[model samples]
Target: MAAVRIRIDLAYDGTDFHGWATQPGLRTVQGELQAALATALRLPETWVTVAGRTDTGVHARGQVIHLDVEDEVVIESAGRAKEPPLATLVRRLNGMLPADLRIHRAIEAPAGFDARFSAIWRRYAYRVADQPALVDPLRRHEVLPWQRPLDLSRMNAAATDLLGLHDFGSFCKARDGATTIREVQQLVWERDEAGVAVARVIADAFCHGMVRSLVGCLLEIGDGRKEVAWAEQILAEARRTSSVHAAAARGLTLEEVGYPPDEALAQRAEQTRGRRVLAE
Candidate 1:
């Protein structure tokens, strides 16, 4: 008779959905999740909360969310004498969900698995093309096609300016209640096996448009259009400038989130992030 916690690992292409949140008459990740839960558990739409809300045209590979429901609904309940297995729940959700959305994994969560609050870090990857010939038509939505040859060395140098904690207001969209300052734990620009330019960033948190704005600035440096000091100057100024042109959202992906082995890792990450904000 006790309530159970359910954690779902899911992914979806944001092209078809209007971001992650539910809206009136609009298709969204939350809307699909609510419907799936409703059919599987015979519940209503008000029982789910996601860890993050991505913007339109974005994508996620390892998004996590938690829901509270009756034990019989999640297949782990001892109260249900004849319920199906957890795997069946996953299979059923996938069968009912659309092609673009999938249930990557599902499980009964541990006692304190607060999806949003317990996360330590989030990682994202952005891909940009330096050569037009290398782009495959099939992968166009997932990679930005930049025909101009880029200077990898210059891009890497510019990225160095963004490696530490700073107020990234220039690169982020202003939010009424959210903070623009964040601790960037890792950032790099390099060529991958296919010789395509890639940008990777990891941080405890990100503000709206932060990753895209960062990419916009990095591209300028790579194209010989700006100096490395330009990145530093923009950060120091802490204001949006015409130079920051974010790449298409479809080229970015939410790679993964870092969680502590125990609560200590989360605590450490939170403290580090807090200090970074204050110093900024």
Candidate 2:
């Protein structure tokens, strides 16, 4: 049987896991999922490619991954159950997976699909509750509780200065030979009915710690600690600074990832790979 690739939609609380990549002795989303897949499919081992690698305490609602396996293996894994092979796989995986992680859907991937390289953009949301009344005790794992009152208007104004293409070295954790240049399509803040300030960020790609660091910078502006122009100045410097530490990871969540149509997937993947190599 031909090897087939499957696209998977998943979500995780991310409160206890040690980020997405596997470590030698530490827990990770990738390690856990790979193990579960191997056991379910009766394979010696399994590996997966993820759309994004999140940090500790960060959550995800629309995360994506791709896995490859023999077509007959997937079919037989269902064990004559009255469901599609992929559906049975999903059910089996959920039963084996921990409560913090969930496999939402799985299906045969369209031709030329590469979960990470084919992605056009990724969207993330950061939730912060500044006032005492707005803080929800039940959601402490997901929302950030702040002492100072935040001004959404100020945060939005500061976020606007960060829009468009630029070298975002100031907001990223140093990575050897990695390019920090990215195009931010949107960086805006708004208050929900519950009065939580949510930062919506969309970008072509993000460097390590980019989203949380961006939110940290905006948080100071919202609380009147830093002037609105501060964000722009640091961005222009294009170097990391001690003043702008990353926000708590709990507040951040990967909400969505965008991809071009099936026909363009292969082209997009090639283009993205070339750009990164050139930039590096």
Candidate 3:
């Protein structure tokens, strides 16, 4: 029997979990999903790998994971091909797991689909509270509250200098094997209907604390505390600089992941990742 591949779409409030990886005696997305899979398949704890490893207090709306199952599991489900009979799995998992985690969808993934490596681009949204009033109670978990009025024009101008490829050491947490280089495809700051300030960044990849630090510097520029050239100046340093500030993690959300629309997209993404590896 051949190995079967399964893809799962999931979302969770990360306030309670330590992170995505499984650690003994700690609740994690991978840990919970592996437990559920083991129970459903009557196998030992195994066969689940995620596309992203989100940090504590970070939330995801469309996270993906891949699992390999025994052939029997796949064969038995082949008759009902339109939709996998994963509703039962979702229900069972929900019943056993804590309320914060949820299995949004479960189905068979395309052949050779690698959850992490196959991803083309990752997008993140960061929210800042610029109003003098306290943050709304409802958004406290997801938005960072900053009382200072920010200059949007200034923030955008500084962020523009960071649009292309650059060594972003100033924005990253120091770590071994962590290269501070990344390509920021898009960056924008805007006000939502509720008038909350939102910073959206899309990139092929991000280093640890990169987004938060970027937000911090941009906010400073917005508030006129720092010059518009500050972001660029620090970025040119090509190493961690004390001048950059890191925003609160709670305000960041993994908004979405970009994939190739067709086979061509997949090819292009692979090429891009390959080049990234070479550059590193």
The best candidate in terms of lDDT: 2
Q: How does candidate 2 score on lDDT? A: 0.93
Instruction: Rate residue 166 of model 3 by lDDT.
Output: 82
Ranking, lDDT, top scorer first:
2, 1, 3
Q: In model 3, where do residues sit more than 4 Å from their true spots?
A: 74-83, 262-280
Candidates arranged by TM-score, highest first: 2, 1, 3
Alpha carbon lDDT at 78, candidate 3? 40
Q: What number of clashing residue pairs does each candidate have, in the order they appear?
A: 0, 0, 1
Residue 204 in model 1: lDDT = 77
Please provide, for model 3 over 1-280, each residue's C-alpha lDDT reduced to its tens digit, 9 standing for 90 to 100. Answer: 7877777888888877777888899988778878877876667667677776888788888788888887686456344545545665566667777778878877777754767767777889998888856479888889888878877878888889999888888888888876677889988899888888999999877888888889988988898888899888898887888877788778988888766654554565466455343245
Of models 1 and 3, which has the larger TM-score?
A: 1
- Model 2: weakest 10-residue lDDT segment is 271-280
Better of 2 and 3 by TM-score: 2
Clashing pairs in 1: none
CA displacement after TM-score superposition, residue 145 of candidate 1 (Å): 0.4
lDDT of each: 0.79, 0.93, 0.78
